[model samples]
Structure formats: C-alpha cells, structure tokens
Target: MTSQYKSPRPLLGAALYASILDSLKAWLKSDGLAWLFAFKAALAAILAVGISMRLELPQPKTAMVTVFIVMRPQTGLVLARGFYRLCGTMVGVTVAMTLIAQFGQYSDVFIALTAIWIAICTAGAARNRNSRSYGFVLAGYTAALVGVPALQDPNAAFMIASTRVAELTLGIVCAGVVSALVFPLHASDEIETTLRAQSSSFFSYIAKTLPSRKAVEDVVAMHEHLITSLVNFESLRVVAVLETHGMRSRSQRMKRLTSELMAASTRFHILLHFRNQLRLSGDHQTLDTVNRCVGAIGRLLARSPDVLDTYASATGTAQRLDRLRLRVQRHLAYVAKQDGFTPVSSLNLATASDLINRFGTELSAYVHTYASLQDERHSRENWLEALTPKTDPFVALAAGARAAAATLTLGFFWIATAWPSGSTALAQGAAICALASTATNPFRLAIQIAGGTLIGGVVGTILVFGVYPHLDGFPLLALAIAVATMPGAFIMTRPKVAGFGIGYCVFMPALAGPDNPQSYLPEAFMNDAVALVIAMVVAAAAQALVMPATSLWFRHRITARLKAEIATAYGAPLRGLRAEFENGVRDLMAQQLMLPRHEGLPIRIPMAWLNSVLEIGTAIIDFREAAADITSRAGLSHLGPAQAAIRAVLPLFKKNTGELRSVAIDALRDSMLAARLAADDATLLPSERSRYRDLLTALNRIKHALRDPQNALGQTGQPSVAAPSSR
Candidate 1:
C-alpha cells in the first residue's frame, strides 16, 4: 500500500510539471522581451532605491528615476546610454558650479549664462543621431536642475551637485547589472539575425539582376529594398559594437564588409545600366561573352548554400567565382579584337566585364567576412573600411537654431514670472527641448510625456505614503517599489506608449521624493505637478511655434540638396569619390523617411526622385573618376577633349529640360570618338589603351543616362508623388 501511494504521487507530480513547463515555453516564445525588460527594470528600481536609502542620500527617488531613464531592452543599448549619462551628468554639474561661482553676486548674469549654455548643449544633442546625442541632452538639462536648485541655497551648490551625480551613478550601475544578469537580450544576437537577413536579401538581388536586365521599374524597386537593407545593417552594426566582446572584435571587419557590399552593388547596377547598350549593338560575340560571364557568376552564386555557415564553405564558392572572373576577362579580350566592334560596343563590353569582375571580388570579400563571424580565428584581412560621413552643416544649423529658440523662450518665461515653481518649469522645458528635439514629432511626444507625468505622480504618491507606511523591512519595501514600478515598466516596453512611459517613470519618483522619513506635503506635490505640466506644455508650444521642421519643408531641403550635390560632385576631387557619392545618396534616402507610393503631386518630389539621384550620381561619379584617371595618366593631351566635354555636360545635369542635355550628350559622344582614335596609337602602352577604353565607356554611359532621364531614373512618365509633407 505504501509503494502504490508513492508511485502514484510521483507520476502525478511529473504530469503537472510537464504541463507547466510547456506553458512557460509558449509564453517565452511570444512575450519574452516585454516580460524580461519589465522584470529587469523593476528589479533595478528596487536595487537603486535600496542603495540610495542605505547610503543615506538626500534624494533616493533620484537614483530610482535614473534606472528607468537608462534601462533599455538590450545590454549594448543600456550600457551605451548609461555611459553617456554619467559623462553628461559630470559635465553638467561642473558647468553649473562654475556658472554659480562666477556670477554669485549677479543673479541675472548667472541665469543668462545658464540659459546660453543650455541652448548650446541642446543644439549639440539635436544635431547628433545616436546615443552619443544623449550626453548633450543630459548636459543641458542637468545644468538647469543643478543651477535652479542652488539658487535657493547658493552655499550648498557643491553638495547638491555631488549628491545628484552619486545618485545617478548608482542608478545607472543598478540598471546595467539587473539587465545583464536577468534574461539578457544581447544586441549581438539581433545583429546576427540582421546579417543573415542582409546576406539573403543581397543574394536574392544578385540572382534577379545578373544574366539579364529586368524592367527598369523592377530594378528600381530592388535598389530601394537593397538600400533599406544596407541602412539597417549599418544601424545594427553601430549598436553591435557595444553588444558583445566578439562583435567588438569583428566591428572593423564588419565595416569593411559593408563598404565592399556597397561597392559591389554599385558595380552591379552599372553593369545593368549598360547591359542593354551592349546587346543593342547587335554584336553576337560580345553579347555571348557577356551572357557567358553572367551565367558563370550565377552558377557560382548558386553553389553557395543559402545560409553562410562557415569560412570554408564560403571560400570554396569564392574560389569558383574567381576562376569564372578570369574566364570572363579572357572572353572579353578575345571579343574586343573582332571585326564588327564599334568604339561604343567595345567600351560597353569592356566596362561591363570590368564591373562583373569587381562585383565578384567585393562579393567574395563580403562573404569571407560574413562567414568568418562564426569564429573570430577564421577572420581575414580587411580591404575597404569606409570612413564615416560628416553630418550636413545646414541640417546641424537648423537643428541648433530650433533648439536655441525653444530654450530661450522657456528661459525668458522663467525670468519674467519669478514664481517659486518657475525654476521647475524652466528646467523641465529645457530638458525636453534638448532630449526630444530630434524626435519625428516633438510636440506629440512632449504632450504624451506630460500625461505620463500626471499618472506617475499619482502612482508614486500611493506607494510612498500608503504602501511604504505598511512595509517595515527592506525586503517588503523592495517588493513595494517593484509592485509600484511594474506598470510603468510594462508600458515602457510597448512601442506606441514608450514616450509616455518615459515621462511616467521619470516623474513618479521625482514627485514622490522618497527619503528616510518620507516627507508628505500635499502642497509641494501640487506645486511641482502643476509646474511639470506647465513646463511640458510650454516646451511643446515652443517646438510648434519656433521655425518647426515640418516634413514638407524637410523634403524641399532634401530636393535642393540632391540638386546641389551634382554640382558639388562635378567639381569635387577624385580621391574619395565613390565613398562620398554612396554616403551622400544614402544619407538623403534616410531623410526621405516615408513617402506615400500611390499619391501623385506635381509640387513634391517623389521617392523615385531620390532613387534617380542615386543612379544618376553613381553614373556621374563613375564618369568623373574615369575621366580624372585618364587625364592624370595621358597628361590631358589625348583625353583633353573628352575631359572638357564632361565638364560642359556637368552643368546640363542641373537643367530642368532635357534639350540642353541632349546637345551635351552629342558633344560628349564626339569627344569620346576623338579620344578612342588617339587611344589606338600602337606606340601607346596596353595599360594606357585600357584606361582610355574605360574612360570611353564611362562617358558613353553618362551620355545615355542623360538622354533619357526617365529610363535612368526608372520612372515611366508617372507624376512625382508627394515627399514628406505635414501630417
């Protein structure tokens, strides 16, 4: 009877355990990030509050609030933000002390200096694009917080600054630890997924484009998708740098891979752009050579398994492609000597051959870097590490101006009111202006934050007075804090209400002002709450009223810049031509965020316009690089006419009509013929002839691109769609 009872109990327990484990697995698959993020955030908040209380800091809530601010879904992002926050806080506190010390006797002078400093920091924050921007935002707002508090008790400024910094540091440390120790979501994991997706998309694009030309419309669509993939890769790589040790070690190689991928894509497009020209020449030999080469590359691309598993597998495929490249070069050399060859036909064939070879080389480099990622020991030598582009000066100036205007408006309001809560309002407005300045919709975000603040205040009040009073021990208090913070943390994990969540977490602890004794003053709560709401409203209003960067205006600026860059491209030096061309167009594509596809408006530039700019710019840069090289080598004697013709045609690209461009193309063609005849001199070296031939091809392609802007732009007479417009 005892054996029978024990057996049944074990069986029943096993069944129950199996069911619970299954349910947990399903839950983790669906809602892991949200759950883990919330848990980590709550845990961090609890830790921060406990540490602050144990240390006997004046503002325990400040430390708790910081945990909420710095916490992110991924370890890399959290660490990055935390690092920047510490730096920004230090800089801000130092600035506040300096200003206070210098202008102690003159309140007006101190206030004025603080406002100016806030504006500058706000400007810097608004201008940058990544987590680095957070430093500037913190610097600006921390100054206001530090300076405004000290106005009441000037002698205690040092103590106030030191305490604030310590509290923030504790908070950052707690958030980082909790996030890392919990179900840690690493950015490197996301990066691997991105790399696989990117590689897959690239292969798909290559398969579709090679061997033959697709419709211009289809090709254009592929290019847009490719550009998006590349941009995503870049963003993921940036975060991946800080994600894991492995990622950090491979970061430079990944960058080089990105550059190679871009160069390869550019070359592939060039081949497609001129493929038709080569076929239309009706030279069966040249056409066959081109077809054979594409087929060879396509077959080699097919040999690789879809997934990049290991270095050995990728190397085998790369070796096969290398052999195919040699065969294609031989075929091109053989075909160039045929009797039916015209200068245009020969140049087209040669350039297409060169591009195919280049595409293979770059692809192999990218594949090697990608496959080697499984193990760092397999990592190879770097070839092309692209330089990061500088931010556009005009964009920086616009952002800075807007930030300054908003900050000054709030600063002036505080000075005029002289209200007791005026400092709170001033500091809040300046902080919001600095942080949210780069947001897509600054006013909307600010308003949401205000709503969050009100909600958080209520929650914080309940926890501090009602819940905490019932909890006597550290464990109970920690539990109480976690319970209070859970709702905000849950909301923070949601994408739509994230801004509201930020406001809630930041304002709750701040308004609650948890301390050892826990001061319960309803008047202070009401005053601060009103001041916070007023500050947000004023900040939102300032952003709305001050030279706001509406989508419509931004699109207009991008359109102008695209036009302006062609002129710049024409005159720019050749050393970094390819990088500048690629970087500039990609930057423009990034700015043209969300253009409606079906909407057609004559006044606005369509997404196609930017796409056209990319293609056209690529062709133009190719022409310029080839022209510059030929001129340098041949001493501008044989290639002078062609070089001059290129210069003459450059200005025609700026024209609205195609008539002048048509004339320019004729002039360019005549110059190409002259250069080709000179290139045929038997005394000239084979390398010189090769350079001349390449230059001819570049010129010829540009002429064709100019002749039919519609074809070049991949537009089929559709009216342009509206670009970014006011929502």
Candidate 2:
C-alpha cells in the first residue's frame, strides 16, 4: 500500500485540533456561573443569622457582605491578598481608631485621614495591573470595615469583629463550594499544554536555523507569544485553588513542575543568541551540521520539559547545550556589539555540536521520567486544588481598599460638612467595595458603582418598607438574602464587581433600612450616590498617582513570551527523544495564538519584532527540513561508504526526531567537528581542504543575522516611555 502519511503535517494538524477542543472546554466552564453567587449568598446569610442570634440583637451583622469579599479567585493570590489585607487592615483600623479616639467622635480630622488612605491604596493598586495591587486597596478599606460601624456604636466592637469573622469564613467556604460545584476550571492543563507547544515550535525553528539562516525578526514574535503563554499560568494559579480535597496537593506539585518549565523556557531564549558561536563565518556545511545536531537537542528539550530526570546523568550535556547557546549569542551579539565587523560568531560551533549529541543521548532517561510521571504530574493538580485557599489578596485588597478608603473619607467628609447623614460615607465605601472587585475598566467601575448603588438602594428601600413590614423573621431574612442577589445576578459572571455592588445595597439597608418608604427613599438614594462618588474619585485619583501602570506594561508581557520561546528552542535537544519534539512545536503555536491580541506599545512593538522573527525562523526551518527530507540522501550518494552507512540507518530523522535527532544528526556533526579543527590550523588536510573550503563558502552565503530570542519575562528593565504613548 502506498503510504498516505506525510512527514509532520498530519501530526501537527491533530495537535492543533486537540488544542481547539481544550479551549472550547475552558470557555464552557467560564460561563454557567450561578453556583458562585448562590454559595456567596448562603454563606453571607448564615453568618448574618448566626451573629445576630448569638448577640441577641436587632441585627447580628452588617459585616456579612464584607466577609464574602475576603476570599479571592486563586489560592496563592488569595494568600498574598489575604496577607496584604491583614496588614493593611491592621494599619488602617489602628489609624482610624487612634484618630477617632484622640479627636473624639465626629472629628473632621478622621475624614481627612480616610481620604489620604484611600489615595494611597489607589496608588498602590495602580502600581500593578493585577490582583496583587488590589491588596493595597483592600488594606485602605479594611479600616472602615471594622472602624466605620464602631462609630455608630463604639461599645459593640467585639460583636462587630465576631460577626465579620463569621461572615468572612462563610464567604470563603462559599467560593470553594461554588467553584467546585460548577464546571470547575483547572488552569494547570492550559499551562502545561501551552508550555509544551511553545517548546516544540522553538526547537523546530532552532534546528532549521543553520540551513535556512532565518532572520532574528522571524523568531522575535515567537518570544512574545511564549511570554504570554507562560504568564497565563500565573493567572491560572489564582483559579486552581478552588478545587476540593486532593486537588490542593496536586496543584502544589504542578506549581513546582511548572516553575521548572518556566525557568527552562527562559534559558532556551538565551540559547538562541548564543548558537552562532560554533561555526566558521564561511563554513556553511559545518553550520548546517551544527544546527541540525544542536537543534535536535533544542527540540528534545521542548518536547520533554516534564521529563528532565532521565537526563540527570547525560554526558557532555551542559557543555554541548552551552556551546550552541554561546554561538547563537555570539551571532546575535554582533548586532549590538560596538566592535563592528568582527567575526566571533563562529568561535565554537563544532564543539557545541558534539555536546548536543551527548545531551541528546541523556534525553532517553528524561523521556523515561516523563512516561513514568506524566499521568500523575498532569491530572492531580486539578484534584488537589479542591481544598486550596478560597480567596486571594487581589479580591480582598480590592474589597478592603475600596471599603476602608471610602468609609473614612466619606465619614470625615460628612462630619466636616455637618452632613445630615453620618452613614452616607459608610454606604459609599460599602458599594465601592462591591463594584470595584468586578470591574475590568476603571471608568466602567465608576459607572457601575453609581448604577449598582442606586439600584441597590432602591432594592433596599423596597425590602425595608414593602417586605420587612409584611414579614418578620425567616421569611424577611430569606427575602433579603435573595434580594442581596438582585445585583449579585449580574455578578454571576463578574462576581467580584457584582458582589461588591450587591453587598452595599443589600447589607446597609438590611442592617439599617427604614421600615417605611413614604419619607425615607430620597435620603437613602442621596447617601448611596455620595458614597459612590467618594469611592470612585478616591480610587481614580490614587490610580493616577502612585506607581500607576499604563497599558504598555500589559503589552510587554507578550514580549516576555517571545524571548522565552527562543531560549526554549535552543534547549530542546536535551529534553524529549521521541515525538515529543512535535509536541513542542504545537505547544508554541497554540500559545502564540492564545495571547489576548490587543493593540499597544510595549506589547505591539516587541510583539511585532518577536513574532516576525519566530515566524520567519519557523518557515525557514520548515522549508529546509522538507528539503533535507528530499535531498539529504542524494547529497550523500556521492560518498559511497558514508551513503551506504547512512542508508542502513534509514528513517533516522523520523525515529530519533526529537532530542534523539541530535544522535542521528551526529554523523553530519562529526564531519563538521573535523572541519572546525582543520579551519583552526589554516592548513587543511587533502580531505579537509576540499570540505572546509566548500563549507566556509556555503556558510558565508547563508545569513548570519541572529539575536537573543525574546524571553518570557521579556527584559528585566522596564524601559520608560519616551513620549506619552511609550510608557
């Protein structure tokens, strides 16, 4: 039967299809989120009721809504956010209490201090464009969460604290429950898949670099894509902890495993800039041989990142890998090198090829490690995350920052103005806490805060008058809890923000809403609106000042990925020994495609540069590989003994394709190594004279442009924008 199988095309198609299915699964899980709100509401109600019953009072808690905000989307992030919240809360409360105590009740000084704290937190939140900054904001707000209500009744501090604690614990539990019961997304799978893909494409590009002489622009784009792919893992870390039971342990393990993968990817980009050092400027065959051998290693690393253990004892591994990295670096360094016209790019190409071959051999063991551990390493994180921390610092901070800042600022603002309503500031802080958590855009957050607060206030008024009057105990409470979800329903998808708004409207009124609507509705609306403005203004101001992040910072994340892919390609030969090489290629392709793909400077400038580099490199590689597949046999046909020896090892490329490709390419590598020694002498043997002359002539004709492939973290230094758009 005539075979229908093409080289790598069909296999590549299958992997692409597999990735599409995985993305679809993620999208499905992201939607259908009612359970999250249900869980939050039930917990909030339970805490409210428990505290109220224990204290034996008109209301057990005004803090239930605040508790729900304590947990965050991811565990580690929650841990961090929780830590910041704890610290910031402690600070804010101490300051509020101290001011209030020193200046007495209704002191205008307290309002000023609150405003300051709000601004500070807003500034801190602006520093990082992520949940981490939210912690700072929450810290500013935590003060009000505890201190504001105390203003209403100083003696009830213990009751307030207890109620808050209960509500917070309940809310955390709810987050876990909701996430667990729902489709339950585990980000680890996505992380691993992307990592693998980036690795492969990188190595594929690197291997073909020698023959195709692809430009730096070609591979630069891959680097941008690579950074995005890896960073997405960080994002997923936030979500992974929402699992139950065994999932927590698995998540921990995955984190460790993934961290190593990240480091390796970074190193691969380093290799791209160094690979050129191995070949003589004019030795084309030597360079091709060098690339093939080293590229095999690069491919292996990509395909078998999870299986490095097998290579623990590999021979000449580091030396060979470093040789390629150094050579590539030499080539790339020339562009930046001030010395101009020096040809140090070919300094050590031959030695590096030999090292790559040794590393390739060691990969056998690494594959063994992966095969043994792949199942356990891959599936357990999802299961382990079942019992991880429910909330992260990001959410807590967002809640705390908005809450504390608004409460204090508004509280003081009202007092200074001799405002008729004392709770107006408190009300605004509460609403801000809820709305900010869910907003993706700051302006939108402000708008939502206003809209949500107004609606929430109306909901509160209706309940306070219509429902509370008609029903007394459980029914009234249940209705109120259900109503807490009026805005909460919008939060089903953006729960943090939605919950933020819902909390204020539902909790404030439930805690202190008037029993009748005739004369009370107007006052409630006014207070809510004032509070909304205070929180929004404070946040916006702070965001504008201290360590503010522009969109450029967000864009740079993609540049970081491109660099990572470059280095990862260089390291592949030391990793996977089988079809793992192919897997690495697909992994990069998927991740490159996965970036949110928006417009901007830090992201686009580097992205355009990195993407073009990686793409061109990838295309050049594909063509050469195809050419090698068709013409390699013919090239050796003239060398009878060598040709017969190579033919006997037919299908070598297919068989030892990944890291093992170095092993098969070793035949060519051995010849190049010999040629290098001959070049060094400046007086070649008869055979060397012919081969070296031809090789050097060929290499010169092939392009020598190379640079460090963009890395995952992009560059260490955050360059300041020269103009308005650059930063």
lDDT of 1 at 414: 68
Q: What TM-scores do the predictions have?
A: 0.87, 0.54
Q: List residue ranges in candidate 1 displaced over 4 A.
A: 1-30, 104-108, 211-213, 276-296, 299-307, 332-344, 374-386, 389-391, 464-466, 567-571, 594-613, 619-635, 711-727
Best by TM-score: 1
Candidate 1 has which clashing residue pairs, if any? none
| Tens digits of per-residue lDDT for model 1, 76-182 | 88888899888999899999998888876676777778878877776676566677777888887788888878866789999988888989899999999988888
* Tens-place lDDT digits, model 2, residues 92-204: 55655665565446545555565556555654654443455556655555555655666566676556545544444443444444433434444444544643464445445
Clashes per prediction? 0, 112
- Scored by Cα lDDT, where does model 1 land? 0.69
